[model samples]
Target: MSSEDFPAAVPIPVLATQPVVLASGSQTRLSLLRGAGLEVVAHRPGVDEEEVKLSCKAGGLTVEETAEALAELKASRVAAKVPAAYVIGADQMLECEGRWFDKPEDRAGAAEQLRALSGRTHRLVTTAVLFHNNSRVWHQTDQAKLTMRTLSDDFIERYLDAAGDAVLTSVGGYQLEALGAQLFTRVAGDHFTILGLPLLPLLGFLRVRGVLPS
Candidate 1:
């Protein structure tokens, strides 16, 4: 988005007693944090997400439980090293009916994902976990249900061409904040939850912990 699209700036916090570190390399999540006026440092965690998903499946973990587990894993990994920082880890899962969807790996995968999601409602299960002093201090999960309007094959092809590789960035092959909004007929829940973070609650936790003004 252009600078004109952003909301007016809030006064950024200058006296956070502990540093905030994000345990993921997602630019979207980073923008969410920075946009909220939190000074953040981001690190891509060593997480083998596919393996984690498989384990969760085999262990009979539900969608929400699995997402929280992944978030905690990420936060704890980063927290272990930065014991003094407020390390944040987040994860998102997309479940349509009983099926789980993941980030599409290629253009063909993107097209396939969109086809499966057409005219269907899916739940974006987003979770965030916070750790400080080498302990998990807080975590939250929020779900956003989005219904994709029936999409024509031609339109999907055109969208893939127009959107290019950007569609592969998120689960369900869409980013609601961008061209992907065209794919949805209805969206219910907090905007940030769909973006893959339970951002407001995370901020609330920080405020309660004195990381931000209450």
Candidate 2:
């Protein structure tokens, strides 16, 4: 959808004057922000995500905390380069039975991840952090609980074949917005959050900060 067709829930007048940057390489997130009528520049923050995730796990951080920390790290890294802009960084985590899942490395790994999640419930925790003037100013986390239907090995194989490399792009081995929708029996959460950005809360924050017309 075009930004004109999907106006911000709370339009901010100042958004026209200030620069906004998205600190990640996710097309999904960039599209989301633009779809909400926010003019934003995309920057790859280049944070070592795996190292950070390992450190957070070793330090006993919960999955939600880890996701938020990663978001802050990405936002902060990009904020330093664009000191005058509002930088948004977001990260998502998939957790099932206390185990956290990362984006699969290959199709085989994606198949394995899906097999493990089959017939089970998992939580998708997505966090968004904002930085302004080189300082962390705001953050929000949203979670979605999804229940996957039981899958036969044959179905898994065919589904993986159909999904191709796309399944590896998400931690949960599925994209609720696409073919992945067939895998879920139930989903409970905001659509944006499930897609890896807590857009409503982030928009609310922007409106409150006068970044959008209040």
Candidate 3:
């Protein structure tokens, strides 16, 4: 929410000479950026994700490619408005046994998704794209594998009730950083990538572009 210009009393210095903008409203991604010492402004890119996903699927694009396409699409939309800044767009997809999952539309959907993912190994595909001057400059795709413990119907209901509406924020109705951890028996991937942002890779790209210290 705050800009890069911190008061002199603060020790933190502005990291980016080129302005940075995040073309997504994800609080997780925002925290990841700010926590890494990059002052960033977040914007809603307003891209129709379902449409993009459907189009990509129809066109025979793999889930990884679809993730990148969705990420770049969001970044490009925002970059068009703020051509001078590095606009970051990101997206995450959840897949299990060839089925793709989207964020739950309601409590019932959340329960349903949980049931489907129960006792299974699923992959989370995350993509991050950077655009400047309305053109794609950088992008990366990363994935994490998670295996959920076999959940009983009663347990699923209780988990859904406990997670509340917050479960609807991410695909697969789980947030690995929070109560969702109980749902998993095993996880393999970068912690940040599981949260739906490739923070390390994105930071590496920013450093290479001279927007961050070497």
Candidate 4:
């Protein structure tokens, strides 16, 4: 059969099984929802991620807590937009020691990030919150610890040359699932968690909410 004539695969199960709204402007999050067979409409929350992180840091919240709060904020914002639909909001933070890392603004910033994370185990805390009818029905946080191998200045430069602006997209200077995989010596956590969703738990929540077939 020609590619166009091939039947579509069955969609992944989701709670409600009905269409839902996803808050935030992340393509990664959108792809994750699509992979799970959910009909998701994307809504970008107009919050400044950096500002939220700074406020959370000033308030002395842990990285994990900050991530969840931001997720909730995004969900709340979008939930207001579509009051009758189920909404999902997600946020991620990278922390080393007590320091919070923001998304690098440029290649130089990414290089600096790589240098700071070198030879250290950093935690990536990803949080997701579900809102329905303007109420938070469920939430979860997935935390992953990744240790980056120390690289020489030459290697860092080469990596930056190869990865370019892609490095600035995530909180850390690398995308573990791509070419950035070469930068890590050890990683401990669920693959989905590293990707910033905690898929299984989120799926479980969806199933319990009747959004996915039981």
Query: Could you give candidate 2's per-residue lDDT for residues 1-214 as a string of tens digits?
Result: 6788985686533343455899999999988888776888999999999999999999999998999999999999999999888999999999999998999999888889989999999999999999999999999999999999998889888989898889888887888898999998999999999998999888888888877876
For every candidate, C-alpha RMSD to the true structure in Å: 3.9, 5.2, 4.7, 2.9
Q: Which ten-residue region of model 4 has the weakest summed lDDT?
A: 8-17
The collision pairs in model 4 are 14-211, 14-212, 15-206, 15-211, 15-212, 16-210, 16-211, 16-212, 17-211
Q: Write down the lDDT of every candidate, Cα atoms only.
A: 0.91, 0.90, 0.91, 0.88
lDDT of 2: 0.90
Q: Write model 3 residue lDDT over 1-214, tens digit each, in one string.
A: 4665765465545676655999999999988888788989999999999999999999999999999999998999998999989999999999999999999999999999999999999999999999988789888999999999999999988988888999999899989889999999999999999998999989988999888989
Which regions of candidate 1 fall more than 4 Å away from where they truly are? 1-18
lDDT (C-alpha) at residue 76 in model 1 = 92
Stretches of candidate 2 exceeding 4 Å from the true structure = 1-17
**Weakest 10 consecutive residues, lDDT, candidate 3?**
4-13
Off by over 4 Å in 4: 1-16
Question: Stretches of candidate 3 above 4 Å error?
Answer: 1-14
Per-residue lDDT, model 1, residue 195, is 90
Ranking by TM-score: 1, 3, 4, 2
For model 1 the TM-score comes to 0.92
TM-score of each predicted structure versus truth: 0.92, 0.91, 0.92, 0.92
- lDDT over C-alpha atoms for residue 67 of model 3: 97
Tens-digit lDDT track of model 4 for 1-214: 6898988886566444688888988888888888877878999989888888889889989888999999999999999989898888999888898788988999889989989999999999989999998999999998999999998889999999998888988888888889889999999999988887878898887788777887
